[model samples]
Target chain A: MNRFIARNGPAYAFLLPWFLGFFLLALGPILASLYLSFTRYDMVAEPRWVGFDNYVYMFTRDRRFWKALNVTFTYVALAVPARLIMALVVAMLLDKGLRTIGVYRAIFYLPSLLGSSIAIAILWRQLFAADGVVNRVLADFGIPSHAWITDPNTSIYTLVLLAMWQFGSPMLIFLAGLRSIPRDLYEAAEIDGTPKWRQFLRITLPLLAPVIFFNLVLQTIEAFKTFSSAFIISNGSGAPADSLLFYTVYLFNEAFKFFRMGYASALAWVLLIIIAVFTGIAFLTSKYWVHYENERD
Target chain B: MVEMTRRKLLGTAAAGVAASALVGVPALAATRIRHYWWGNPERDKRTFAVIDLFQKANPGIEVSGETIGWGDYWTKMATQTAGRNMADLVQMDYRYLFEYVRRGALKPLDEYIGKSLMIQDFDKGPIDGGRVDGKLYALNIGANSQVMVYNTRVFQEAGVDADLINWTWDDFAKACEKISAKSGGKVKGADDLALMIEVFESWVRQNGREFYDANGKVAATVDDVATFWQFWADLRKKDVVRSKDKTVILDVPIAESGIAVGDTAMSQFWSNQLVGIQAVSKDKIGAAMVPHKAGGKPGQYIKPSMFMSLSRDVKDPASAIAYMNAWVNDPAITKVLGLERGIPVSQKIRDQLAPGLSEVEKLSINYFTAIQNKVGGLPLPAPKGAGEVRDAFMRTGSDVVLARTSVKDAAASFIDDAQAIIDRAQ
Candidate 1:
């Protein structure tokens, strides 16, 4: 015991604070919520055990649950690609080796830094409002204006647009990945009289596949967990025909507003499984396309 | 010095933490209690002033006030309730009173009445509004009812001088149509009131029925709600009310609504909200009774705007109850907090605050006074999971206005969905 303590004591001490936080704050609640998923806990009263009832109802009868799933899935499908493409395009633009690259990177990165904040979400709501700045700008070109944020058919698209606008994080990653690619390969392609588009298709696309896969999986999970902007824009009730009812937003309402903590726990677990499945699919499919420089041919 | 071992070091740190926590608890023998409330900036200011007054009056008691916006209040309270660390004095709403009381989160105030809590002069109606299951769990701080607050300038410009007091639904619709036509579509006649469950309840009560039956089921049929949505849908088609896109921003403060922004001439809200609306609006605002059905009952009822209750885990019930008593019955506190929460329920406080009210407050008071005797009895408290039901109603109503679904289908789905929410909550 003395020898063990002497060998690992300092390292364990260094990790004690995080260990305390994990055990007391994170792990305890995580396990408790897992147990709560099988019960009916309203926060105020005792949790009543009703095994699988919350899950059964969530799967079979909850219309809002289905609606939330539909909205979140649609958002993930649209937002993930839209954001990645925007990020890659911007990263390519910034990769031109300009003298003011640092300044431009900072400027482009500002939106993502501010993206998930309540102030930015509120600003997005105002920007897409009926008589807001977006409409005013559209009016200057004689384009008829529409309420982009509140219209049921168009509201989720506004959130997607917000996601595309805040492509700073992935853009930085892509910029790093682009910088690491060998310039000699591109020069050799140029020497062969390869067209710019074909070079992009053959070399740049294949080389960036690993980075793209990484960003795709990360952004897809982030898209599925979207809450703050959707909650703010939809007034926290998933308004305008439940078009903005993201899964996390619906889970929040079920837990906090309605106090159905147990049901919300079940919903949360289902969301976790959905994200895991998508990530798994992405990983399994990536083997065919993604290549690493260190990997054997 | 002894060489420090891991166990000894951990024991010393634990002892240090325990000592610090113990030192933090007692502050010169003065009783410390927390008072929590949810309101806007104006109400927060008024509430803090009252808290200061209470602290000043009782030097032995130290009161700290915790204020949050309305949206976050319930969530915070639920979390605190779960942790069993709720504030000593909790500001509650009528919709949540039954839920909190049923869950054993509130202390029954009946034992403190006429002792530490003074309410001998209070009226029975407001008092009863705070009772759940025959026990007084909270004290009503203010009483208010629904009313139509209009921009007088827009009304005059549109030449809409219909008898707002005795007007029927048809009269309101005609006036709205005229307002839109006269404005040449520059301004909508009204913000959408169709999604307001309070207005729907009023309509139900006007037809000589309560919104909820004795068994806690919704008494209004799907057809009744369908008709209500159809009325608003026709108005949407005529462009009298704001469109679904403009009207669905329900989370914004009342001061940001269309009527306050001059995009609409009128809006339906509680009487107490008139001061807030008028404060932000440029036009001269006036209040009137909500338009009832022709030859039907007057459905408006004075509602307890909010309540102050002692949490079950209160550390100092005497201090907490005293603060609640002062909140309602004290003239000094009422003078500063006049009509900010709602109209004060105490007769003496109302008499004291009458001359000191601002012009907008006077307008609210006048409308409230005129409609006091004419209103019907208070409706039953909302069922559990009413917050979800209200959201479902608004979603269905918005669907009808957006023309995403027929009114009949939306109403049917809303009824089925809301009932299921209520049943699940049970």
Candidate 2:
């Protein structure tokens, strides 16, 4: 132990700052929020412990809590798969040695690069507004315009479209994963007279499992936590009847808008648990599908 | 994205250096006060001008101002208060005053009244409005009556003479329909009524009841709320006002609002917003009182535009009070502020500035002043959970217009929701 410490002391010294930051900056607030979820706080005043009141109220009383959960889950269900499929499709296209593929990748990557920003959210709002360019373009094609973001029935779909539009980062990851797949495997399959579709299903699908899993978990979490675009499109009030009321937006309104800090803390904890559960489900389910090259299982 | 992170890191490093540099300066050598407020650009310009005047008048006192948009201001204020980094002075709203005072976030100004505030000729009506629990916690900046601001062009185009001063709900409906028909569907009459809290409050008042009681309960009956929704829904059906979808589309900014764009004839607005709304167009916009039910009490009553109060953690209450005095009572500030904050609450300032007032300012002042004797008593002070109630009101309004629920059911559910929220807060 002494000899190992002596050898790794310099490495440990270099990592000390990050370790300290992880404990102090990241973990501290997380634990504090957990404690706060059990309390009644208005931010301006002292937090009071109310045992399980916040949890009980959330489960049995708060209608908005249920609505937010429903909206968030629906969004994750629709957006994650749609975005991942689009990413995989585009990555496959770019995997072939097409000229200007780099430029095309960069251009495709631009939307996700700018996706989470408030400016892009504002631009998205403008494009999807009732009289916006989307409607104007539709009119040119003799298709009547629909209130895309304004109508309650269609607002969440616009956000799903936005989520799908930002498939760039995952696409890039998929492209990298695709490149790492050995060419011999596909060539051998083709030599056996396997059809291209069958080879893709058997070879590409199995080889890309780790990358696909990563993209799925990352995007599902992101879709659950989406705030700015929905918040902006809904004018920060979650209106045209709360259709754009994403979970994070609802939590924000509860904490900041209504000063229900304790309730918001509980909402945050619930969101953390929900994401953990979904991620857990993904991992438990992945063993049957995801194949690692050296895994004995 | 790569550029954003690099710039952010640089910004943090620069801020660290600047903060460390600031550590050397003594903070209390001179009385330094930080004031925070939410306002539009015009009001910001006017307030800054007044601050400059005050600074010139008192060189020993150093004052800095910070501002945010109205929507985000309260969130920032609550976060600051929680962090104990509250500004020495804050501009407050009537809806939020009770909540802040109840939470001990505001400083009581009763002790400083005679010493710091020179209110010799100040009107009691405006002063009394700022008191909470019979103790002065804030000072009124200005008071404005609710008004119906109309674009003259739209009204003319519709060939509708909306005499808003003596108009009733029925009259408003007929005029809207006329305007919609006359314009050949190029414009709707109004989509404004459904979302306005004050408008609903005033409707209940005209029916001889306040929308919210002194306890901040939902004072209006289901019938009262139902009637309000039914009125707008009927108007929607007749195409007198915009449909729910159209309403949401025009909900961007006043610049793009139906009235400002000459798509609607009129909207209910506070008198102080007259200039900002009129600034978007050269259409000779006009102002008149809000309509009420026939043979009912007047729907127009003055509301304090905002209040200026001392923070509970003020470093120098005396300096803060002195600055507040200069802001409210000094005649010179009247020239700089004009009617940007609504009519000046100080009688001396109002009389002093009346002669030099611009046409727009004069119109806001004259409209409210003319309706002085007609307006009902002041609406009850908003209670602790007022913000949530207001939101519920808005949500309920949307629910009604979208036919997600019937008007009566929405009203009943809103009452239940508001009561539960208020009770839970208690």
Candidate 3:
């Protein structure tokens, strides 16, 4: 033991802060919440062990929970693909040889940095308002407009648009992926009398599959965890007929507003399991499509 | 040489830590208490000034003030309560006072009432308004009631009577239709009042029913809710009231409400919010009673705007109670606060501050003053799960107005969910 401690003491010392943080802050709360998922706790009173009552009620009776799941799933389904496509399109444009490409990249990246802020959420709300700038611009063409943010049917789409607007991070990663592809492959395809569209399909897409898979997984997880924008635009009560009630917003309301901490804990575990299932599916299917250059035949 | 320097660095850090600990021990002897409140900038300024004065008077007692917006206040309070580190003096809402007290998160102030907490001059009604289970757990900070605030200019432009004191629901509806017609569809007549639970409570009372009975169960029925929702739905269909979109826009601060922005002629607001509404409006603002039920009971009652309660685990009860006493009874503090929080609960403080009040302030004071004696009995304290019930009720009401659900179906589901929540909480 003494020899082992002497050999690795400095490395252990360097890692102590992170180890302490994990055990005390992250791990403790996670385990506590797992235990709390089986209870009835209103925060002020003692938690009573009800043994899956919260989960039973959530699955069988809580209509709002189902609504939240539906909203979140719809948001994820739309936002993930929309954001990835926008990122790839912008990234492909930036891949062209231009002297001011760096400046354009910086400008495109500004949105992701400011996207999740409360101010941006408020601005997005105004932009989609009934008489807001979008409507004014649309009215110039003599097209009738509707209240975008307040209309239940169209409100989630506004959030999806906001997600699309913040395609900066993935765009950067895609730009890196685009640059790493060899120029000679495209040149050789062109010399062999391949059209631009066919060249893209045969060469560019197969090589970029790994990057696309990476972005898809990352963006899908981030979309499921969306809270602040939904919370702010919905006015914190999932307003306008609960159409904007994302999963995290609903969990936050249940935990804090309604003081249903136990139920919220149960909801949180269910969400974790859902995200895990999605990620596991992505990994298990990756071998069929996402090929690595260094892999053995 | 490098090894010697590293050892010296470690010794210096140890010495610095030891010196700070020695300094902190002396500072710990002085009693420090935290006060938490939810308010806007104006209330924060006044509350901080009062805390400053209290700290100056009692040199050994250091009082720290914390304030948050109303939206996040209860969430923070619940987190603090769960951590067993609630502020010594907690600013509480009436709907939450019962929950906090019943959960044993708040200390009963009855034992200290005659001693450190001096509120003998306060009115008995306000005092009793703070009680739960016959125990005084909080002290009323101010008294106010619900009212309909209207723009006088809109009434004149529409050539409609502005006196809403005796207007029945039918008369009010006719007036609203006339106002909308007069505006040529530019200005809505009133906000969608069905969105507010407080306004619905008054309607329930006007119909000679209690919202919640003595047993803390829902006393208002599905028919009552359906009738109220259908009335607003019919008004919405006629475009006499703010549309669902407009209502969503105005569901913000009182200063940004429909009446304040000239988009609507009138809206339902707390009696105290008239001053805030008047401040933002270019038109002449006026306060009047919410329309009555023709021959039914007077629904309006004096409500404690908020309460100052002591945490059950307050480290220094005497100091905290003394601050509460000064906040309620001190003439100088009352002048600084004015009618911003609500009308002062103490008659002496109200009379003392009456002479220097602004015209807009007097509008709220007069509105509450005239109705103080004639209003009905106070309703029972809201039950433990009332917060959830209120939000669910508002969502259901919005569903009705947005035409997403029929009034009867919305009311039925709301009643079912509210009863389930209340039952599960018990």
Candidate 4:
């Protein structure tokens, strides 16, 4: 036992720094945030316990909270499905082995790399502006194009499109998943005279379910925490009648802009609970669809 | 085995020595004073020059200056102040002056005013506006007042005089209609709906009702705000002015304004923005006092463009005050800064620098000087919910324009939202 301990001592010591960082930097802030959820910390003064007040205000009173939730859900509902389908389709096309596969992959992945940055958000703002490139093209086509970002009705959809255009990460994941699916299965299906659509449904989709689940969870989490794009694009007001006021944006305003740190912390906890519930449901529902090749039924 | 043991000992000793040296070094080697301000490129260059001048003059003081876009300045300041890591000296806006002061973030400057700096010649109003509840928390750097800046060529093409001193709202609308017709819709009259509350507050004050009560509560009714909206709404209906897509340049600066870029004939902006407005327009740009209501008192006020305040938690209050004194009161520093800080509040500095002003600066000075007789009381310290109120104003105004709500409903909703925000803060 002593020998075992001695042999592993240096290995454990090597891991100590990372463990300390994880606990102090990551875990510590989360725990602090949990405590702050029950307080009325305005960032200027020390936190004062306000028990359920922030939660109560969020659920029952804060109209902006509801508005933000609606905007976020609308974005996710549209963006997630659209992004997934587009990614899968593009991945399938790329998998067909085009001549300039590397160039195509790079082009497809470029938006994902750039989309989340402030510069791209600024570019997005300019592209949708009244006299901007998009509008000028529309004008060339003899179609009257008003300010897309300035109009309330169409602004959120523009954000959804921006989110959709950055489907490269999910596409790459889907592409890898598709490649991992055995070519023998498709060959066998073809011998049995199975249709291409049926092969895709029976083999490709069922096998790709796990990858889809992974992508969905990750993208949903990222979508919920979205701030920079909305912040920079809307110029921080979520303008045109708060059309782009997402959950994180509202939380930011509460915490920083209004100095309601406790309220924001509560908001953070609620978001965690929401994500937990959603992820739990996704796992629970996966049983009906996801297939494991090695597991016994 | 002996050789391995000696090597291990040497490595351990070397690591120990490195660790000790690293720990022995101070985290902050110098007494660093963080200074934050917002301005244009010209202002930024001038401010940096002043900082260089300060660093040269006072070798002991290490000052770091961060400049951000004006739109983001307050948001960043609010976050930093709330985080309790605010810069030593903050360039403060009048709209947010009371909010920060009431939160106990700003140090009272009364003690340091005469001892650390001299400002006896400056107007009492501008200086006193920086004080809340008799505690001087800020020092006015410069003053700005609202003015109507119009393009001379656009007005000439429309056959309308650009001087708008005696103009009423009706006259303004007529000019806009005429300009639009004459310019073949290339030049509209004004920017998006002039903020309703700003105009409404002024209107209410002119009609003998203060926008805010003595206790700093909103005094105007929903009907008052609705009437203000109706005037602009009518202008929109007549096609004299543009709506959301055409007029309102959301979340951008006055320099990037469509009106200032010659897409429109006139705009309501701060007098100090004349330089920026002129930079965009090839045509001659001129300024006049904002038109008052017919037979009503002028509701214009001399407002502080921005103030410099010391943090309450600052380790060296006297030094911070000294830095502010040098930035604001020093003749050489003021010359370098020019009217980029807005028109200098220090009468001595203003007199010294007035003669050698640029055309834009001269226009700004003349605009302020002409309205010197008609200027109303100084703007009050904004209340706690001022940020929320400003947001509500923008949101509710958009709602009204979209026809999602009546002007009356929008006004009432704004007041309710604003009141709720204040109540929550309290």
Best by DockQ: 1
DockQ of 4: 0.55
Candidate 4: list runs displaced more than 4 Å: A1-21, A97-103, B1-32, B246-249
TM-score of chain A of each: 0.92, 0.93, 0.93, 0.90
Docking class of 2: medium
lDDT (10s digit) by residue, model 3, range B1-426: 999999999999999999999988887638989999999887898899998888888888989999999999999999999999999999988988878887899988888877888887788988889888798988888878888888898898898874566678888898889999999988888988887888888889999999888888898899989999988888998999986886754258877678887788888888766667777899888887878887988888888988899997799898888888888877888888898888887888988998898999888877776776557888888888887888888788877777888899999988888889899878
- Model 2, span B1-426: residue lDDT tens: 999999999999999999988985775448789999998888888888888898899988988999888889999999999999999999998888888998999988877777778765677887788888899888888888888887677788777775667778888888888888888877777755776677888888999888777766777888888888888888887877865675654245667766777667777778888889988865888886777689898766887888999998899888889999888777787678778777877777888887887777788887887788878877767767777777888888887777888888998888788788788877
For candidate 1, what is the DockQ-based docking class? medium
For residues B292-393, could you state the per-residue lDDT of candidate 1 as single tens digits?
Answer: 888988788999998998898899888777888877777888888888778877788888888877899888888887887778988788888788788888
For model 3, state the Cα shift of residue B157 in Å: 2.6
Compared to the true structure, candidate 4 yields what TM-score? 0.92
**Residue range A155-217, candidate 3, lDDT tens digits:** 999999999999999999999999989999999988999999998888877889899999989
Better of 2 and 4 by lDDT: 2
Q: What level of docking quality does candidate 4 show?
A: medium
Order candidates by TM-score, high to low: 3, 2, 1, 4
| TM-score of each candidate structure, all chains considered together | 0.93, 0.94, 0.95, 0.92
Give one digit per residue, the lDDT tens place, for model 4 in B305-416: 8899888667666667778889877778889988866788778888899888998889888888888888678756657776777677777888877667887788788777
Candidate 2, residue A182: lDDT: 98
Which digits, one per residue and each the tens of the lDDT, describe model 2 over residues A1-297? 999999999999999999999998999888989999999999988999999999999999889888888888888899999999999999998899888898999999999989988998899888988788999999999999988887889989988998999999999999999999999998999899999999999999999999999988888888888999888888897777878778999999999998889889999999999999999999999998998987885
